[model samples]
Target: MNRISARRGGASSPIFARSPAGSKRTRARIRGAALIGSLALAGAAHAELLKFETRPDGPNEAVVATVKLDGTSHDIAGTLAKPAKPAKPPSGAKALLIETQSSDDVKPLALERGLAVLTLDVAKLPDKARAPALRDVLGHLRGALKMKRVLGRAQGSDADAMTDAASAFDGLLLHDANREPAAPTRFIETWGADAYWREKPRVEFANGAPPNGRRFYLAGIAASTTATNCAAPVNARPSAPALRALFAALDEWTAKGVAPPAARAPLDADLAPAQDLKWPKIPGLPAPPEGARRVPKIDADGNEIAGLRLPDVALPVATFTGFNAQKNKKGPPCAAAAAIPFAATKLDREKNLDPRPALVERYGSRAYFVATVRVIADKLVKERLLLQQDADAYVAAARSAPF
Candidate 1:
């Protein structure tokens, strides 16, 4: 028999001294590693929960809640993920708070994918206290606007109050103390619009701006199907130009100094220039709004549905384009198309992404989350609710069906 030397914990020490029978050191090393790992795990704990300073006279001011990692809840704040990077809002850009009536968990699915998210839980507000609180904030913003006009300057406290209130409501509180306002303070209150009577409001009120504020409300209740309805004349879809028009209108409103009661417009120079993002040029294509555009899905049928467009199209098309499963005599690509482009190592002779896990680990959890969610969604589509051809169309409908 050949003579053998032994080591312990990768060291030359006799810590791995042969058992009376001269057994290998592997077992001892494995046990030692396990013990070290167990001790390390026992020392760690989850971060403490941060409390929102609820104002007695504010929305959810009296709301008190707690969130645990494993226990699920309907609360959005409860699902807060630690920020993956040191990302801040665009300069002069404030938080993009969503105030929707839908379940908080529902909208964050969209927000967590990318759009700036802050869901205001309207139901948490006690009925007896809702009206007065709304009135108070509105009055305060209105007063600040007036003071700025009379004194040729607003008191620091007044501006702070407006910023604070807007911040509280989860609106982008662009600080303009010195910078000129870039857009008019035109109000886009969700409640006053006549659109609500036409269809079930798909726009989650809780996932958008305060109804009482002077910001563009993507009236979740009224236009949940904006992407699909864009091409439909009867539905008044928000076309690409229509979105740009909203921005242009705001630019004009700011230039004219036409400030709404809940909005304060100081100067245009203060606001940052709006970058021209390459919005999808395809007509009837459903593209997500800023911060929520990571993955956009379109309704293959002419109906509205919550969808994720097939990912990584090698050849880009502006509209809904698909191969006929019957005529093409091919199986459906929908099953895995969204993730196909990202998976290919080379496309059209171009060297593409190396299909590797190293890149994902370096990018933080977002990539992992997207991939995992996509896989889960794929499984859901294949074995569960997503495959029904009419699923998208039915979900596009605004009203909730009672069981």
Candidate 2:
């Protein structure tokens, strides 16, 4: 949130000023003060709150608190959103504390399930201090905030600290490589096959998942990005369908003692070298990247046959791939994934000599395509992988999608 401050002095740049005297006094300037604004306004009638207190952060809510660590006070900040409740407050007090950079999409998922969503700012601490700081913040959540159980999600980079502090949380989701969790601490690790990197993973997937330690390989999915540097259409499949259901399963496993869905990433065969892959000749498509960097064996479709199939993958529209062609002669490919739409009709497919089936041959019509998406979305929701609202949204977006 921008904390505005009054200024009377002149500066090189244009200064923002606030008018006073019933819209009659535009002053010299107004500026934002880092700690100064917050501290300066301390004790004001509407000063920011403390101890589960909150302030409006634009359209969202920001939970603000000050907690002590090693005799120093640190601002513990995060967006806090509570799920809708009836006349009487919900009997349970639970929350999910996620690192700021962790996916924001999952916040609503936790809220929908009655788990209050909080931010985990302790990851900003130094490596040596993050564990203790996380523990301290979590203690504050459970003790001072009166939350009975506090869950957490963080990126893989924070694994060391989160693992050390795992016992402080009831459940933890880390989007990183596999790691052994401290005993009795529920944990899940996820890697979406591609991170916005141009190069594919240099290593092959292996088995031996830890007890209660689940993993997901978002195969055939491109890393999420807004950049258009690729030679083809960017593939950004809606992760909501996958994540909605995944979060639900995670909640059931952590709160109700149910089992998480079996991990979907199993690369039984070693990755084959780029030169060895028997890629089909698709006219007009860029050549595959040449490197020893291997990939899991793929089916007729570019994606691996196993693992979770998002609606886009389950029902084909175009070849949705996380990998996009690098326009440069020699360097990393575009950071975004690509979605190459199939020909609209069999005649068009033959005209282009495209090996992939035409959209008409595959889906018949746009109406049928949308109906199929609804069916997939509904099934995922039933499996606890997709939320109903999100399912509806998917169907809605499908209606307007270019078939």
Candidate 3:
């Protein structure tokens, strides 16, 4: 009578079946990083506009400028682009001031909404001259390009440089920044909905530790990476749509004085010491790290309890986490998260001694699973947490998934 106990394939499997403990097909690896902090700035304002033109292969105006480092003559290139049509410098246009090199989505998505996009290669800038050089660049965009109001964008350590130069722009949209930019220069920080950095008991949340009203999640690396040492699949829930929607909100906030959605992420109560996390006893699941790191508390099903639950998180066929354990088991957790799919049915899970529910128990049929994704995605769109186009794409992907 326990006939559903034999077959196995996970979400990563070709048809989303069950993954047995011994199956190599279930493993996904990963590495991770990001944050914001403060540092002193140095150097003179040495910058010059180089060239502006419309590339034959592109539909938007191409802008090139340079900001020379203070002590050295090295110049960091900058690009300022308008929404559409081969054109010249813009006048009275709101803009997005990108700091570090970010995902390709931000520029095109913002441009699609008619907001001007300006990119600066700040990662290449020397540490000391960054703040003032950033200031000088903003002046150029405002004075020469006639940008009306501009919002700053940066991620990880580069986000800190934006804070050092925070006052130059109207607003700043940052990813994985730990500290909030001091007041008056309104800002919104994204800590990556999938995972966060915590410093044991001393710090419950290393990224946005105190939990500011303007901080939230899902403004993360456009794509997740797989590494050799990780124990399972990296938690690579598609975050492009979430990222685009967040940018749209920031654009409205900086340009038209609109308020973005309230912050949604793990609060003080949502975190626990690494060892204290309530992980399910899935057979062959890697052991968690034992150290000063803090992680999000999980539900009975072993998925995170807070933050933006994307389709993979909301309508889950597999379990996911922010930090994955290293295969060596002696070192700290691998920089990235992990993904492990559920067994095919209750009988299979029981036979395998897997505590997490089987996929069949969670979604009795493919129709229900796909419908739930649509419902969750539509809600995110209404909440300004996801773009409509992205929502449609997710649904279509679900229809074709090896359900």
Candidate 4:
């Protein structure tokens, strides 16, 4: 019989005392390691497939998706309008533009240009929560689709949320009246030609470090605050054209690395340049507490200030305002601003308190108005701001408008 030696604690035996039950413990340890490894593999596999639900909405496809982040879930809703597949593979990277609100009329335009638009309602993610949620969503998108570039477009309060989440993305196009400072971010505001409210650059970067790396672009449109409501059925504003043009420019910049030129003039509210005039405070509001700021000053002509004047504004069809007082006294302090058509005739001018030059007078006649629109459209197209297809449609719309 072969002699066997076994050690237990400190003592040694020649006839091996049956190996202690610790052998079972060793086996259990091996099994635990294998279990953990399998779980990690399962998690890796699960992460490969993000879930999205598709529903049919007439000719469009509606997507409802739930993205998980930090053990929590966020719901995203969007509409998809995919064009017919091209004969050849698309040349550039497939891009995604995320709108942090309902889908706008511009989605179809993006689809026609070979981009996918996903509109997310981030109401639950307040200003503070948006950054982390956006990061997780973008991460998931990157992993699931292997997307290399993502662009963000948002409006109003949603624009604020995008500012908070700006650093993680390739680019952002913001339409915000109350915009916060961020690096590598573009701010676009629609101001009424008659409103006193103006925006100034609040944040600046040093040495191109934090807050998204020192790339900043700013542009403003002379239009009412409500002008950005491109989806509004009856009160559709001229803002849609400018917004579409901006989007086209951004798309080219992002896809082809061709940056649109910066605004040629000061786009912010630096009232001193316009005139050293002070604005009057509203009567009933309590005197602003200490450290209060004054309202932006307007120019002698009563326009808020000069900005990146879009054709509808630079060329003149109507006067738009950035601010409006609520009609009802009990309502909110300010109502959404609006646009009033420039007087069409002398009689129309006589009825107004302060009438602007009528559109008919400026363009001379309906035929001239159409001709002028065509010229402006051509100029915007040359600047790479307006797509040729959109420019043609815009000209046609102007021709059909009730001048």
Task: Quantify all predictions' global Cα lDDT against the true fold.
Answer: 0.25, 0.60, 0.60, 0.50
Q: In candidate 2, which residue ranges exceed 4 Å CA deviation? A: 1-77, 87-93, 102-104, 121-129, 159-161, 178-180, 195-205, 270-274, 283-290, 328-333, 401-403
Off by over 4 Å in 3: 1-70, 85-92, 193-213, 218-224, 327-334
lDDT, candidate 2, 202-242, per-residue tens: 34435556776776666567546665456777777765456
Candidate 4: C-alpha RMSD to true structure equals 14.1
lDDT of 1 at 39: 9
Could you tell me the TM-score of candidate 4? Answer: 0.64
| Local accuracy of candidate 1 as per-residue lDDT tens digits, 1-403 | 1112233356432111122323434554443222221001111221111112122322222322222122222222211111122264221222122322323322333233223333334244333222222222223222221212100111122222233223222222221121112222222322111121222211222222333234332211122322221322122222121122222223223334433323211122221211223322323232222232111122222111222222111111112221101112253211100011122222321343333222223224444434543554454345322333223322332122111
Q: How accurate is candidate 1 locally (lDDT)?
A: 0.25
Clashes of 3: 7
Lowest lDDT block of 10, candidate 3: 28-37
Positional deviation of residue 197's Cα in model 1 after best superposition, in angstroms: 5.0
2 versus 3: better lDDT goes to: 3
Residue-level lDDT tens digits of model 4 in 71-93: 45566566655455556424267
Q: After superposition, how far is residue 340 of candidate 2 from its true place, in Å?
A: 1.2
RMSD of each: 25.2, 10.3, 18.1, 14.1
> What's the C-alpha lDDT at position 56 in model 1?
30
TM-score of each: 0.23, 0.73, 0.75, 0.64
Which candidate leads the pack in lDDT? 3
Runs of candidate 1 with Cα error greater than 4 angstroms are 1-89, 92-98, 101-116, 131-186, 190-403
- Model 2 score (lDDT): 0.60
